[model samples]
Target: MVAWLGSYGTSYFGEKAYPKPGAVIMQYTGLSEVTKHEPPTYECVGTRDGIASYHSVRSYIRKIKKNGTDAEIQIFDGLTHGFGLGEGTVAEGWINEAVRFWERQVK
Candidate 1:
């Protein structure tokens, strides 16, 4: 599953209903109170994101990791919310990193 912004929330909310996904890649998502499932997850967010707090993402990832799930996260400096693929910003190579993370999950 690949989700951005608001859709990330949907993924978190629906985790219980669906079979565990192979992996999840989320960007710029807010905090959720839902239970964390064991799945490899890769998440990224800009430090300057206004819509979704970077701290929230960090906390969520930490919680997932504590549950013994493989979780990875990246925080790009001076970036804002909704910077998909990070475009020409400092986060430009994020998509490649995400792909690599997904590949690791498959292995």
Candidate 2:
């Protein structure tokens, strides 16, 4: 739905990434065969990440859960999509939160 930044391309690290919902729908092509025996899933996404909205991730989590799997969703606040890229950027805190969440989940 980020067609607003078509000039910069869909991969732009700026405030716009996903040009349309098709970008998201296309990603689900691989999930069409998950059947019903998959393990629990953990999904972490940033609210401000235009590449993939936290809402979309939540929807996927719901689907996975409906199929009888545990799905954990973690949404970071005030962080951009690139929070996992740079060390000294604003995304560092989000990354730390994700790491902590992962550690807890793994244990």
Candidate 3:
């Protein structure tokens, strides 16, 4: 499993994004083409990741479900975005969830 922030258009949000119009357009356009996935996906993202907005994850999950997959998202309220799994972190909760989901899917 891998976790990463959608940093593709972050440059538009960076300084020198004059007029705001260009930045807005780029942001919307980027979101329009988010990735797609098949069913049986177990996805987790933090609400406070500050990287990809909640909307991005929500959109992806919806697309997965529309494709008939079992997609799950566990959004940690106080955690920053992209706090991915590690050996000795609270992210263990998410890892455990994924393992459980994988077991069920494989069964």
Candidate 3 residues lying further than 4 Å off, grouped into runs, are 1-39, 86-92
Instruction: Return the TM-score for candidate 2, rounded to 2 decimals.
Output: 0.48
Clashes of each: 0, 1, 3
TM-score of each: 0.79, 0.48, 0.57
- lDDT of each residue in 1-107, candidate 2, tens digit only: 22222223446555545532211111111132243443445555666777777777677667767997655666667655655543575434544554554465456
Off by over 4 Å in 1: 1-18
Candidate 1 per-residue lDDT, tens place, 7-69, comes to 244446654444455778889878544255446778899999998889988887888788887
lDDT by residue (tens digit), candidate 3, 1-107: 12112323324446443221111101111132434334355566555667666568667667756766566666555566546573354455677777777777657
Model 3 Cα shift for residue 46 (angstroms) = 1.2
Which one wins by lDDT: 1 or 2? 1
Ranking by TM-score: 1, 3, 2
Model 1 scores worst on lDDT over the 10 consecutive residues at 1-10
Question: What's the distance in Å from true for residue 58, model 1?
Answer: 0.5
**Runs in model 2 with CA error above 4 Å?**
1-37, 85-107
Each candidate: what lDDT? 0.77, 0.49, 0.49
CA error at residue 102 for candidate 1, angstroms: 0.6
